[model samples]
Target chain A: MTKTSVNLENPQGYPEVPPKTDSVSPIVSRVREVLRRHKFAYLSVGTYIASMVVFGLIVFAKGSNPFSVFAVVVQSTMFNGGSIEQIVLRTVPISLAALAVAVPARAGLVNVGGEGQLIMGAIGAAGVGLAVGASVPGPLTWVLMALAGGIAGAVWAGIPVLMRTATGASEAVTTLLMNFVANDIMLYLIYQPWRDRFSSGQPQSQPLSQSAQLPSLFGSQLNLGVVVALALVIATWYLLKRSHWGFALKVVGGNQEAARRAGLPISRLLISSMLVGGALAGLGGMLNFAGLEIQLVPGITATFGYIAFLASWLGRHDPYKVLIAASLFSAIALSSNGIQLNFGLNGSIVDILLALIVIAPLFLSKNRKALTK
Target chain B: MNGIEQTLIGGIAGGTAIVIPALGELTSELSGIVNLGTEGCMLAGALGAYAVTVATGSAEIGIAGGAVAGAIFGLLHAYLTVYRKADQLTSGLVIWFLALGVTGVLGTGYVNDAITPLPIVSVPGLSQVPWLGPILFRQDLLVYVGYFLVALIIFVLHRSRIGLLLRATGERPEVVSVAGIHPNVIQVVAVTVGALLAGIGGAQLSVGYVGTWFDDMTSGYGFVAVAVVLFASWRPLRVMVGAYVFGVALSAESVLQTNGIAINQYLLDALPYLVTLIALVVVSRRGGRKAPEALSRALTDVT
Candidate 1:
């Protein structure tokens, strides 16, 4: 047994050689290191192109010219005036939704409840808007509606926070489940007491008064909500990059035990980060409702929360990048309508494209250590 | 039969659909790979099976196609997580989004189509028994297969050497590797098999229960199966019971509505999710010592 025993460490029974360092030039190694460092960037671009090609192939398979689909999507989403306004309107909510995920992510928490929080925010805004739209001055009503929406989002987000702090449950699952609950709650409200009496058949609340509606900007279809979203993005960037609370959140996210040892209030930070995230999403919901919807209706959020989650991930949680990613997603979403109208393709084709963009980079790059973090 | 009896029977059938996926999830989790994309796999399976059934006019072939579709997605997940070392949760979510989009696009054609659903086969004399007969004996072939499969899983998990090795691989992959086996292979197999079961569950939902296909028809049952696995504490018998409990909760609204009970439909729709949350809270508070050590580490941020 001793004679036949194999050394696992050197199973091949080959002598070790060390000549690689001398053969390879220092400049070459330096170049290699730089390439490796920028590998993810290259992979991201490659994946994006690959995803577009795949989408083109899918369109081609469906018997429509791939070039036409691309042309239609871009022309409809960007070139057309009405569609451009639609894209901007859509971007506002999506940007906020992305911010909602980005904030909590800075605290190392995955808040998938943005959808629920967004819904709650819409409900809160609508509740406030309806109650005071007829009585209070328009400006005050809008302010109150925004505040109520923010508070509702915070409260909705706060439930999972409390659950996480009290019991070590996964916020991902809880938040996902809570979205359904929020939808139900909204459904109950719209169907029962909030039903518009004059509307007859549709399940929706009455339209907000003219004063309650968000004013258009510069005589265009664009509204004040886009400005609000941009301001919030800048504020989020400042908070994440330059504030004591943000620094504490980064510390907490990096290492919870280290933060605790450093005397940071871990629970409070977690709760507050989530609350802020919820508030941002809520604000987005309010802006969306007030600016575009002008009334509470079923599917008001319309998966903006989920799309925002994707945008945040694509942006790597950076506020500026999230804004860009949100805009890109909005373009894709808006273009889906054009593809459906022109090529008879389903609107969900955009989902496949988005999923491919996210997944294809994994296939291109070997370094996955970034994902675990 | 009375409304109570009808409700009970319907609950059993509903529960059976959930149980198949829950069992599959339990298997995957036991191997330390949490596939959150079970819902996606189920959707793919539902569409795949429905399509095949429509094309070939054979329910069995449709079921097989569904399992194959699930296995393909499972392989994708395994490649991303086990080979590429991508984050399991993120990979699962990506796979889900992929399935959702693909199915939504392809399944639009089949939305209005119908197929001959799997017929219920009652046991000869036992099906005639007063109360328990219809609930237990009169069920589709898949339900009976599920029962046998559960029993087989219990045996394999508790009584077989392979089962012990699988459990060991999940708990301590390093140890398994040292003992001359690749743990990754085991993990991949477990996940693929688990996804296969989830797909079958989806097939059951479309063919055995609904008899029709729709876009995203599995809804959140795959996620519910994840919760059900937790609710069962990774035990086979408990998984069966938990699935039925969820099934009952799901069917309660329709049963009440059918019986002329005026309830807010949305509230009933929300019950299963609420129950899942409550169950998760209660179970977590009680401490999850029964969870595989490596799986707990995989899921939670706590070191």
Candidate 2:
């Protein structure tokens, strides 16, 4: 008879006994195995904790009670229903803007011009709304503003896209450069041509007519933007992960030479990806403009493009994950207002927290494996 | 004398800030690291220098403070990208955001502070020489140092063993390792030193140029420096030329404003970025600079 060896995790007729797993309990070992498999979840939690601790130190250094600061942050953002509404409202634009980054990323492009594209979208929407919003029916006004916004965003993204494909200029740099140009253009408009003469204080455009505002959800504080955002999230998930075009984009992004050899329209696919991203960002602008701030103003984005860019990275470019990340970031951002009110801390402290959260993941995991691959 | 001579003088002085940072970025890129945080490093330097100057009443010491601040940032970048193997661009952007926030938080007390600007000096003989004299000779102390640095960097990069190793590391780290040198160590040194220079540049901007502290006072000069490095083809002398071109543009803004010209200040603010975008496209199309092989890998799109 052959010699038989006994297994440690389980043994014949000994299923009830704990394995020789370092003399640990069977349930404990099983839980350890699950934790090992889901290291990313732990990594994110660890990073979040580390960031909050660092932020607490900052608050403490400023002579505020760190615990109270944290409590205020949590209470102001999480406990109240009104804050949740603001977070969800903020998520609408952020999620759409994140999709802007996510889509182009699929085609092997970094669309750092989200800020510019979003601003252009807002400008387009404002132009259309101010021009024809009152003359047209409300529904038609919405349609026209959205189209203008989307087309403008596409045009903005198209500039760097054209430069990249035609001249090999790095889109990362070019797109970033465009943000300054877009900002200046907006400033020029508001400071002069588009200035609302009837208003005082900070310069802003004329407010959209009441009819042009986003319709409320059954007389609730919520508007149609969140619903639209959700629909787009699902739609983008389908198109990017399920369709042949999406498959082509993957091939192009993964290996350009392979895409070329496979007869994929590499340039078209790349361009289309970026254009759709720009359009989505523009649509985000329209939603925000109609849904909340009814007028074009400086600081309109509140760095939405940048925060959304970070959110895209946090989500690893998955549209569904991006939405969640967007919501989370929105909560973090809106907390700044409360923090400032409560502690008199500078508003930019939120940037430090966001930076810390984004940076922690950079080094915590297996080096290259943790990149946005 | 008209504003033309004054503009030329201002151009050389203002250009010094940009040329210094561009040289720093060139050094970093030659080591296979594209630090997008050069912007943040400059901000760190600007605030550090300004704060130090306010405390000690010494612009010279403040510039040193700036260099130290920049080095700290550089060290963080080196650790993240070189040691931890984090994506270079991501590490860079995060550092920049951190710098932006930190400076904003710390720079509050110095917003209204003032200092004695770097004194303008002239070489007596050079000052006597026609059109070039007043234009070139009459510049702040940092401008002269900037000239020396440009010449020194050109010699070091093209002719020195260290630069050869740096270029080798950027092109092929495997080869660098085979040659019995630690490539990452060299890269760390190069990046840190590069960042130190950028800090000095920021110090020049605040203590040497404007003599006052303000939020984002460096504006986007650091970014322009990065662009300048690219169009300069990583050449030190061309970096000066590129920087001076921007300096002229910036000084032109001031000159036009002082003359009561009607161009919108906001539109004028956009000029540098627009020009950078246009120049980048033009230079890239012409193949004016060859990017390091490693840099191309660093910038590869990730999803």
Candidate 3:
């Protein structure tokens, strides 16, 4: 279809010539737009910086020298072995979930059910691990468990897509509702069938065999999952930039009507996006389970999946950008632990501090001024 | 059966969580802006009020604090959804993540007490009457207000001029624009008002019902509110009915567990959602009646 026309010439009931204004050079104008958008991104970065400054002030208020606290936060998160391990462990899930969400986002579908999908995948993989942890060899058990996790996560996500395609229901509501459903399923598995026979009444599963565990790649709480996450990031970047399927997904994501008119199968594309996204999220869950926790319990996801959603947005849906954003958030998350230990800070303050990072960008965009009445 | 009475009581008590948010969501949906951030808004309000009440020892102030927090969330949402022309769904999801993360961090400083919620105010003569009296009149003040809000919303939506205009904005915003009313202003008002009510609903949970706020106290109440809105077909009064149904199911599961019944608590907890899913299927089969035509369109378009 042609672009809709506007009656731009009509002014005060008379045709008028367009008024000329001071114009920037084309290169300069393009540079300004780039700078303006980057300004928004930096606005977000500033909040991250501001939060650290605020944390320092809070430490000063509590009678500690601000410099010492800053040094402690920096040194612990950046140089301390244990803190670095925490950052590495945290990065795997955040990066994987961000990619999980970004892929579907690139395809124009929203998967708020990432938390649920991750939980379901964990449950799926945990069930597989527990059932076969005793008999299967190490490598095959890990692969099969990861596959089970991916399949379970995909199926959990598929429910919403199916409902959307079949009944024209909004996926936002359905996928969100499905989070509770997946959580309940996880609860049931842990509390009932999967409850470790030797455990006292806590809602947890039996420990997997040593063979079911992922091998540590760095021997510093960093596991082979980090390798897998980095590899996936590179693979995802290539697939989106070079693959035909990725191109189709992006087309359908950006505009379904346009994609449909161009002979793309919208339904198939939507479903495939959900599957891939769900699989990535599930893989994140599998990594969390095998690489870090090694057990399924209530609050198993620890809301990390949701944090990853923010990281994905911060990255603007670019896998490479996602890596940087994830690492930044990982640092911020590490600082929370340091702040708690050194300054007796409350843990939840991390969220309040992070809010600044999430919110400042909206105000910083040049378009923001133009959009508001 | 006596079993049904217990379920109804539990449902009404439990369903209060859904009523306010769903009603507020209906307003937003009516104005053609889907506030997917409702859950986050509610959670923030709940946590904010809970912490404030415990710290200050005043429920009213706590409730107001929740409202303020919720309004701030609404303002952010308006800025992104209306001003920036970002995808409403994405912006909402972002707000939710930010809220969840921030609440988790800030809540560490808060040491909350077990809430002694507002007592149920039984209307004297009405509460003295038989079953209906005890069931309806002998309820918490918020429950009564919830019903009243439903009636008020129904009247506002169908009869009032502002309501008509709001409906028009949702259904055919272009028509409203042709009449010289800015659709964005209408949407902002709708979302703000809706968020305010949702905030109250969450506050009611902290200071009026459950009497305590834990991390993530909302437990997907906002998500259920969406389902309630759809189940009610976006009507104010019907949403109350839907909320009551869901409330009853949720309450019944807990009661069953308390009574040591052999029924699976897991299955029971899943019941309300399963029913909601089924209701969604049925609603879709019938086709949504007179919904906002431009509900899912980009906010820049008046229609």
Among incorrect, acceptable, medium and high, the docking class of model 1 is acceptable
True-structure Cα RMSD, model 1: 6.5
Model 3 residue runs over 4 Å out of place are A1-73, A197-202, A365-373, B48-65, B101-115, B171-181, B298-303
Which ten contiguous residues of candidate 1 chain B have the minimum total lDDT? B294-303
DockQ of each candidate relative to the true complex: 0.43, 0.64, 0.38
Q: Which CAPRI level is candidate 2?
A: medium
lDDT of 1 by residue, A45-147 (tens): 7777887898888878878898988889789987887887898899998989889888988988888788888899899999999888678787788899999
TM-score of 2: 0.92
The global C-alpha lDDT for each of the candidates, from Candidate 1 onward, is 0.85, 0.85, 0.77
Tens-place lDDT digits, model 2, residues B238-260: 78898998888788778878889
DockQ of predicted model 2: 0.64
Is model 3 an incorrect, acceptable, medium or high docking prediction?
A: acceptable
For model 2, the stretches where C-alpha displacement exceeds 4 angstroms are A1-44, A365-373
Candidate 3 residue-wise lDDT, B1-303, digit = tens: 376677676678668878988899899989888887788888878877877777688776788878777777877787777666656765676667667765665665564466556677889898877777777777777788788888899989999988998999888777888767888888888988888778878887777767776778888788788777875778787788888888888878877887789876776777888778778877776777745777756422210
The residue-by-residue lDDT of candidate 3 on A1-373, one tens digit each, is 9986666666346656588864878899888888786865566577567756765565566567878766766887888867777887888877877787788777777777788888877887898898886696889999998999889888888888888778767666777788788788778877778887887877688787888999997556788888888888898888777899899988887777899899999898888888888888888888888878888888887677667777887788889998888887777777877777876755555665455565555445435445454
Superposed by TM-score, candidate 1 places the C-alpha of residue A344 at a distance from the truth, in angstroms, of 0.8
Error of 3 at A79 (Å): 2.1
Worst 10 residues of 1 chain A by lDDT: A364-373
